[model samples]
Target chain A: MEMKFPMKKFIFYKRRTANFVMLSLSLLAALITIVPLVFIFYYTISKGISNLNIDFFTKLPTPVGETGGGMVNAIVGTIILIAIGGGIGIPVGIMSGTYLSEFGKNKFGILVRFFTDVLSGIPSIVVGVVAYTLVVIPMKHFSALAGGIALAILMIPTITRTTEEMIKLVPQSYREAGLALGIPKWKITVMIVLKTAWKGIATGILLGLSRAAGETAPLLFTSLGNRFWSTDIFQPIASLTVYIYQYSTAPFKDWNDQAWTAALALILLISVLSLVFRIITRSKYKA
Target chain B: MVVNEQVNITTEKTKSPHIAGSSLKISVKELSVFFGKTKVLSDININIFERKVLAIIGPSGCGKSTFLRSLNRMNEEVGGNFTGKIIFDDEDIMKLDPVYLRRRIGMVFQKPNPFPTMSIANNVVAGLRMNGFRDKKKLKEIVETSLRQAALWDEVKDILHESGANISGGQQQRLCIARTIAMQPEVILMDEPASALDPISTAKIEELIFELKKKYTIIIVTHNMQQASRVSDYTAFFYMGKLIEMDKTIKIFTDPELKQTEDYISGRFG
Candidate 1:
């Protein structure tokens, strides 16, 4: 009896230990996926913080070997590109998303969803090539407009997918409540569904914006680069990603420092945008 | 009880054409609803009179809510095939534009679903705004009156500009009631309006229903037999997609003509 009691207790301890081991392993796997993002943030901030200064944002980019310019031109170019790209992308993406969520249970909606998925998975380089053939070649020059169009193409799929998913999350009860009150179907979609899913949709657009902001590959063949400040949308303009890429590869310490600074600025801008969006969504939830 | 009195008045009026003939706000005939190949609700006939409360009582899946939804053509939004005639205020509701028909017959849901982003005043006046009402003064008046009618005026008057979602769940449900009233709809369909609320809130809603009967025709669907007994003048018992028995509330509960209704009321079966 004493031996049997000890044996049972030992088995219980062994089972508990095995369970804890399995739990820890699963947790480690999760952490493995999250650790890279942490590393990226740590690496970028530590490397770039010393070079961050007002001059990095207020002055123009220096030539290959020179040292006294900033990323002022790149900053302006990024803003212009994002604004025009968003302008081109938001309306079309929102409409398609609405179609998929509200009217897409049929064959046509399925077809649209299939194409959207395909568009979303296409390589950014492929988009650059397409934009080169369509906008840059047609205009007979490298231009900010071509870059914006390429970014817009990248943005559409993200926006559409997010919008569709967000709209789908809205409870059917809300739609039924609106319809029961005699509201028109289109009115329900706009006033009720859109309003209910606005935060999610906004977050989706921000995600698309962030993706476009960080892209260096697409603008490589399209926007090229400019040394001086340029406001013309139809002409080539320097952006932060392109500036970072160009300066980081050059053989000068100052140019390399400026690249780090530009990268830091880009990171800070996207983080602030995401933080503001999170606050808005959080307040909505509390309300 | 109020239910017995209302039934007597309804039957007497229907026979003599003196009391309820002019008050018949909605007349439904041979209504059937199908979701895809499966029929959800069979033929239902009901006459809703003005300034009276009609309660639809049944177990789950008895088509009570389905029948209630048919009043405002809410079923149309569910992608179902509906066959029947619903006449409201001398117009065939099916023949009328759904938007226009919905304007005249408002509905409240089981759950409190105030638009989270809108203010209390905005929620009350959503229907009016949808129909292009823009005058601030007129809107203010309607909002106040509707709130009063919903018995939510005092609780919400001080914070009308606060977000609708900032209020309590019960208050949100009352806000929905105010919203429907602001439309000035002739008929109001409520689908278990108090089901999600606490008992106190349910009582308040029941009291409000009594008050609302003075101005609008009310049709309510509920699983609570006591609630049907307390507020309604007429009771309709639905079973398995068909309306089994409809009579004065007291008679339906105490002296039901159908065994199924008797069994349901006695709690022997749902």
Candidate 2:
């Protein structure tokens, strides 16, 4: 009973060693994941930086094997496709997500969530085929509208699920505060619940958009690729992803170089989007 | 006004041992609450009087919050069902639309829950706008008055444009109070409003409660016996889903009728 234990010695050393090992392991894992990202930036930047210039952004693609060309039309088409896709997807996703979180708390909501998950898991190429049959066949041509539809379908579930999760993250107390003021349930959802989660919802939209921006398989059959500067959404349109796919696969050396530059442009667009959403999420608490 | 008519009608017929002939604002009759299957409050009856501070005091899990929330049907939000009759003023509140009824009997929760997405001015004016009051001059007057009444206007008058969350904990609670008062409810239900605050803030809230009693009948559920005694005119003690005793705050602390009340007031068991 009088024997004194080793004063904070035995457990302290053990805990310190264990903490060190775990910390090192975590650091290793982080580096391992970051290494691949660094490698991607390395290759894309090294290969693409030299090809980027004014003509690369402004001029139309020269015929097949030409030395100098740009994807100006493809860039414009991608922006239009994203606009149409996001316009169609974001509002519907937010509303459906609101219903799921706020009012649609029954068996039907569970089924809706399950179906949405399954839809997201479906292959993008398969979705492209489905769009080919649904829109391309009826219209008798592959148009930018069809491509936009395919991208919108991909975005809806991703946005919907994220919106629902973000809305759920809002404290129930906020809703109660709104209801205590005799605000209608729908009004409460829109004014209080949705406003509180708006940043998170916007992040979800950006993610969906970024995913849509990089997609190639879905647009291959839907938009079917274009070579000219076309403003008509009903007509076939070119996108950065489609141009990359076409040029990278072609035997022409110059076309492959243009494809690398197009890839860089897309990467920059997505990173900028990701950065904006990140800042929005960060500053939301300040608001 | 209907409460005045009821006071006249029941002035002679009622036989009450404590607080006799108090003009009743709300009458609870055969009230019982159940969360799905488990019963919480059982056949509780009390007369909440005109512009009075009624403190519902009990230990944790004693159905105190349940009983308080039941008054304004706020319990429904948490899936609590009650089988009873609560006559608010002269009307049975059970039949009234909950949204309309809540505007008349507003609630402040345990935590200070000001709308975080709004400015301080907007938070105070939220209920007024929800009720379709758009006159900016009148809205500004209500905002100033309510904040002043809650004792927060002096500190925050310059920063009305700031977000509700950009304030101290005590100030946030006061802002929530201002928000509720802007609604101009006849009855304000507070579930441990001062429980989350420090001593100084608690004292401030108690003083606000005393001042608020001039216009509103306040029902505050507090676990602190000292707080109950300090702020409330009438105190109702609850124990194990039953009304143990209810009397003037002085009598409840000094000499309660029930043994459990004495045990709790003496800090025997929470």
Candidate 3:
């Protein structure tokens, strides 16, 4: 018996409608997520553009009611803190990641991974409290060094996780190819596996840096805040996030305006660093 | 049919004692592989002579490639339990350091998987450098010679500094072969080296295999019977994890001793 043409036509129409609905829903979800990012950029530039100038970068923070103070101290402090934090974090993170991916098939490795995951989930405020006890109280003062250590602790788990994931993404075939050539296992991991995943590892490092750049709660109790330029890492240092937090709650109107400018500066710095890292990594594969 | 008759005559003549007394380079005895309690291959016994090409032919899941991998301890990477005695140059390979053993017996995989990050010349000399050869001049010589031997030097000579991935598919396979040969291994194991290539590239590989057999002992696992007949001196037919028959290549193709061998060669089953 031959089927009627109208029945076949109806079936085709139903399938096409189902596909259209799925595509439309996906598009809607994508737009919904992008809306917040667009708004954040628009608000930041519009509110902070008038005050963006060299003076805002070069001058120091003033008294609560005065204007014309720049964020030079905060900028320098942020640089020193990040440098110290990354110095402590990157090596340990890379080693831990290598241990987890290369030797983690055993019981000890499992414990290390468990601890790292736990550390990653701990709140920034908790890290601040811990740093206050371990570093601030023992040293008898709030110092930039203490804040850097706290941020390093936060950065380690992120770098380790990213490095482990990148290492795992390297194909086993590359390792076999290296081994078959009589290369030692360590050389294969370092020269072949690591080189292949270098881009991913870079991405991971940038992500960790971006995360550490905006942290405020940990620095509040450890580094506290400074009103003038301070190069000594052992002394209390001002950072952009902490400055914004401190100024936004003050009684003076000018301090609040300066807080908005500091916030804008931090956002710009992070975005530029991320963009540069991305460009550098992408160029590696382009050639 | 006429070609078969001529091949049979030549094979019978070559089976005489005078031709069968060549020196053995590799010998496997009671070699079996098990993947976590599941036995994949039974006892595999074979003697591979120097400067000869031996082809392993079988259906899928027949453990031919498994046997080939065991010769160089390539199976060690699979994380399985294996019991075997593979002797290369009178030394038990399983008892030796796998890294050292692999240096003497290199392998080429089915797919052409060159290191994506390295230049063509670097890929060729990677094995040499890995084994602690630091002399730049000598490394360059080996790279050039190996690529020339693999028939890739003329095409890639000018662009030796280019990424290996920039080459065509056939050239990449030859580059892999060149990389393996650069190790100066005495024995080379190929796991369906030509299966992924086009007809022209397949012919080039076959010709290269023939030329290479003069300097190295080769054991190849191939699904293409024509390739086995064209290139091999000895052929081993495997079925269901057991070796069914092994003889001179012509005998395996023309007048196999077992019914199953004849059925397989005739394309009745795999």
Candidate 4:
């Protein structure tokens, strides 16, 4: 006996319709996710572009009622603060990270890892208060050094965790190859394993630096903001984020406009940092 | 040399099962390996001849690789424990510093693992550079000679500074061989060196082995029976963590004393 069954036609048409509906939904969700970012960029550029000029970059702030001025000191101050922070943070972070990945298989290592995770979760304002008591109170004054210390503390946990994870991404076979060649364990970690993970480590550094650049609460109680030109580490320093905070709250319309321009400058600085790093660490093997 | 004295002493005590002109290079006695609670290789004894190829052939999970790694203490890297006396140049290798010992006896792994971060020329000289050999001219000479010996110089000379990984699989394996050769070790241990390569590449590696033994004592672990017979002067058969039989390659293939060896060679069972 022969058996017969019904075969549904246009089943492919149904699948195609379902696929189109799902694709459209995902595209809509992705566009919704970018709405806030697009709005921020739109407002920042439109309000800030009119106020941007040579004087906005080169000249010092004027007294009340006088409008034409720049944030040169603030720009230089941010650079110095970052340099100081990175000077303290990069080596400490990389070394500790190396220890965690290469030799941190014991209880002490687990404790250190836990503490770093907790440290990264601590509020930025809390770090500012800690720096206030540790550096500002002891020195009897707020200074650029205090701000730099706060930023360094914030940078360490991010850099350390990223470096450890990046180093772990290197294949175990590479370490074996180095050991089989009679190279010492330390040499292999530094020369081969660390070098192999360098691009990722650099990305971590950039992330930490970018976070430090945008921080205002940490700089509030530490550096305490400056109005005059100063390069001294022991003296108070100005930063763009601090200026944005102060000017945005001021009654004057010009200061409020300048705040938007300062935000634009901050964004540009971070962009330049990322571009420089991308060039420096670009792979030569890309075909 | 200390090696000459040890060879004379070993030849006097051991029966003459070696090739006519070859002398002992490495002698293993009471060797066993364990990983935690599991035993990998049982007590084994074998003699490796100077400048001669010895192939350790066995099926999967037969502890042939365990025996090869034990020669240079690379087993220690993976937390393997061993109980044995491996005499190299009259020195008990277990008592020697592993770093210094490994320099005298280098190894090539089953896969081609050139350092991806380094260029071809740099990969060839990584061991020397890391050991603080800074002579530029001599380093260049070693780069050329080592690549030539590994049969890769002609293929890669034009792109010496290219990344070590940006090459064909066979070229990369040959590059790893060149890297091991650059160290100028007295002995070379290969753990299934050509198993990861294509047929033509495997044949090229076999030819390189023939040329290499004249300058270094070679011990190779292989699963291919024909490869063992074609490239090795002597062969050792391993099964269930024990050495079942060992003899001249031709004799082992033609008329092995053990039935297991005959059974495996005839494709009866692994």
Candidate 5:
């Protein structure tokens, strides 16, 4: 097992060289991943910041060939759509996730989990079609409700799975402690298990919100993109993503400029959502 | 022979001041436990005296924890199947509601598990609060009393609103004990409660156990032999899921009737 001193030094150099090479390769890979994100942010901000002004946020889109207007209606419509989606998705996701983690250890649980994975993989366009048939067709028009429903369907799987994982991350000892106190199973799941994992679950919700906010395909057919201010759930509603899609494709230069601004605003909206949730759920004590 | 020894101990225990008028709080008859197809405990029979601390000591995998958990039906939470009767106040405990039974027979685990999301005061009263008890003044009183009983109040009184997990390990364990005490259970089960604690904390817990048994019957499972001797009035030695011996603590430590018990306690072998 003994090696000569010269051989040992040679081996050490070779090992050190391998370590250096691997570290450089990993650093290269990390840079490769970050480069595209940096480019996208840089391009979006530079092209969008010039068009962004107080009017861009306060006024409705101008008539065709007219110059000065904002996407205020689209912005408001997007918020309403997100509110509806969250109203439907958050409770369903949390309850189902709680069910899966706490009581779903059997065949039914496995089946439900499998279906959730499948649902997450289904194309957003296909969900749009499903919402089209279920809501738009039934109501006889493309509406904000249909778009919200489509987003809710898209959000459910992310929220459900993340919630289950987060709840599972809570130590088994916490459940045992609750049970030993003679608290009911439902109470323990709600008050102790859910409370402990809320920070993680909030992040999951934020992920779902960001994904839904960025969706263009689903809202394209479901909301159908209105030109005027409209807040009614039954009427067509404009959203930032849909406006970005419509304006970016039009031949007009100003519409294309506004599209970039809409993209920036969409990103800002998600960032604000994340910040608000962080502030709301911030831990009061050092952990 | 072991059954005859148990009878002698019962008769002898009746003479001690601590056991002079204390009645049988729980009786296990031919108890056995299984997790799926694997048996973990078999054909166990024991009588627990009221207001006395009975310690179960053995090597790892001897099913002492399973036995302690079975007392409160917490074993069923981990999917354990059981056979035979456990009588509490002349009723088969298996037929009783597991929730109600657990309320009557609370447990403290080997690791301190104060609810991390709760404040120190809130953790003490979590059981009551969760069960629909909403009286604020009563809850405050219960929190103070339970904290005092668990011997953690003075150290944590000023920081009652801090997170339960924001304390030292021993304090957290004592906080868990206070949480259990808030329920005012008839029995408290401790599963290697102080094995995770330092010596000073271990002494504090042992002293708490001594004070607690004046009101609640206790069953503790421990790997530490000296801890069993120091805290328990009666000690039962288990080897390979079987109770090798049960007797007064002094006898178990000084003059155990079985060779296995003597060997295990003297550190000859587990």
Candidate 6:
């Protein structure tokens, strides 16, 4: 095929067409990825916003067939479990991470790293089973402690890996400077390395907590879900995910509707937590 | 301790011509450094004088920084291991606690690395606090004195509470120097300390080095031959982990005995 126009103009037109086609394809890919996420938000808001009320935050659940039910206990219970999980997991994860990045040339560091990797790759439900065996069976009953432990186990691997990576981002010169000043190694690790990497570490902690908060299967095997309000941690407790799991599967129309609202509540809780972390990280004294 | 000092004085007077006039602060004996399995500095013997500026000039990768770091045992942090003895003012280097040794032989790195989380004032006195100096008045005094010594107090005194990273690169490097000096070290080692700065900052750092040598024994490593000639009383030329020539700075620049040293000085090749 011979072109009447100059070859330079023909090449330029072809190049422009190719650019347009590739750009459109990339935009279409982004659209396809975002559409599902948008649909999820739209579906949840449409189904659950009408069900949301002041009562939803304040009141306890009604019996299975009853109409006036709220997830106040489940919400409160979720907070307690997350608090417990984070309390145990954060310190362990951070210390292990410190070992990996700072003193990790040895065999023990490699062993710890391998175990953390394996733990993170393990299924969430398998962790639930381990928690069930270690805590639930030993106590002869399901308890909130067991549920908290399960979530903590799942959180450790993510927090450890992220902390290690974040600490690595701190320059090697900072450590050298501290050492040259005759500061103790432990003091340098805690004061210099940890402080410099704290913001990144906090992000890792938040991600781990958010991931644990939405987990259902881990809580299912350990806490075993309670319909009524319970305050004692030694006793079985209701959680948002467990409540949603149960309520969504129930035959009653009102119960299924409550699941939608419960999911929306969980999403809101994670979002608020993330927003709080973001603000704290971006504050004036960020260093 | 008194007898040991007398013996060091006699040995310093008789055996070493290069360090005859000035009293010795540190003596290196057959020191060799290795990073993992690879040797970086080998079979080195040198005498560093008290209250004098010594410069180590070499091309990149010649292990100048490694030799400087070994004086304070800072090389251990970077996977470099060494064999042999370093004597600091008559005490064997291996016997002295590393943490304590570093307090008396502080170091300044090539890059300006201030603790990001600390204020300028806090960065200066970090070492003092680590050694159990808790008096706020004393800490304030040390910060002022050290910052003045580094020629940074006038620029940073008003904003002592600001983050260390908030300062300019030159200021940050001076802040690192002030931080090291606040420890009250007897000797200061600088590893190409002005390599990352602009020419003006480099000049300022060189001036600071001249001022610093009156109170502290200083060992500096430099890539720029002019810098070595300007600020150093003694110059040691290293090539490929070996000290090729060691002499007075003027003699090394004007009348180096080795051909390699002459070539490097004349810009024939690195």
| lDDT of each candidate versus the true structure | 0.84, 0.87, 0.85, 0.90, 0.90, 0.88
* Error in Å for residue B141 of model 5: 1.8
Per-residue lDDT over A1-287 for candidate 1, one digit per residue giving the tens place of the 0 to 100 score: 35644555688899999999999999999999999989878877887887777877788766666667677888889888887788898888888999999999999999999999999999999999999999989899999999999999999999998999999998887787677666777888998888889888988988998999888888998888788899899899889999889878988787777777778888887887678767765543322
Candidate 4 lDDT over residue span A1-287, tens digit each: 55486546678789989999999999999999999999989999999988888998898888778988988889888888888888888898999999999999999999999999999999999999999999999999999999999999999999999999999999988888888888888999999998899889989999998999889999999998899999999999999999999999999999999999999988888898789878987866431
Task: Calculate the i-RMS of every candidate, to one decimal place.
Answer: 2.4, 2.1, 2.3, 2.5, 1.5, 1.5
Model 2 lDDT, residue B168, Cα: 92
Quote the positional error of residue B260 for candidate 6 in Å: 3.1
How would you encode candidate 5's per-residue C-alpha lDDT over B1-116 as one tens digit per residue? 12334445544432221244567788777789999999999978788888899999999999999999898898899999899888887779888898899899999999999888
Candidate 6 residue B51 Cα shift, in angstroms, is: 0.5
* Distance from true location, Cα of A109 in model 1, Å: 1.4
Pairs with backbone N, CA or C atoms under 3 Å apart (clashes), candidate 6: none
DockQ of each: 0.49, 0.57, 0.43, 0.59, 0.69, 0.67
Model 2 misplacement above 4 A: A1-3, A7-25, A274-287, B1-22
List where candidate 4 sits over 4 angstroms from the true fold.
A1-14, A283-287, B1-16
Q: Write the residue-wise lDDT of candidate 5 on A1-287 in tens digits.
A: 66555465688899999999999999999999999989989989999999899998999999778988999999999999999898898899988898899999999999999999999999999999999999999899999999999999999999999999999999999999999999999899899899999989988998998899889899988998999999999999999999999999999998999999999988888888889878987876532
In order, the first chain's TM-score in every candidate is 0.90, 0.92, 0.92, 0.93, 0.96, 0.93
Residue pairs with backbone overlap in model 2:
none
- Candidate 3: residue pairs that collide: none
- Model 4: clashing residue pairs? none
lDDT per residue (tens digit) for residues B8-127 in model 4:
554443321456677677898878899998999987878788899999998899999999889989898888989878888778998889888888899898999999889999999999
Model 2: how far residue A104 lies from native, Å? 3.3
- How well does candidate 1 score on lDDT at residue A110? 90
**Candidate 3 wrong stretches, greater than 4 Å:** A1-5, A8-26, A279-287, B1-21
lDDT, model 3, position A19: 96
lDDT of 1 by residue, B46-81 (tens): 767677788999889989888887777777667676
lDDT of 2: 0.87
For A138-190, candidate 2 gives per-residue lDDT tens digits of 99998999999999999999999999999999998988888887777777888
Candidate 5 chain B weakest ten by summed lDDT: B11-20
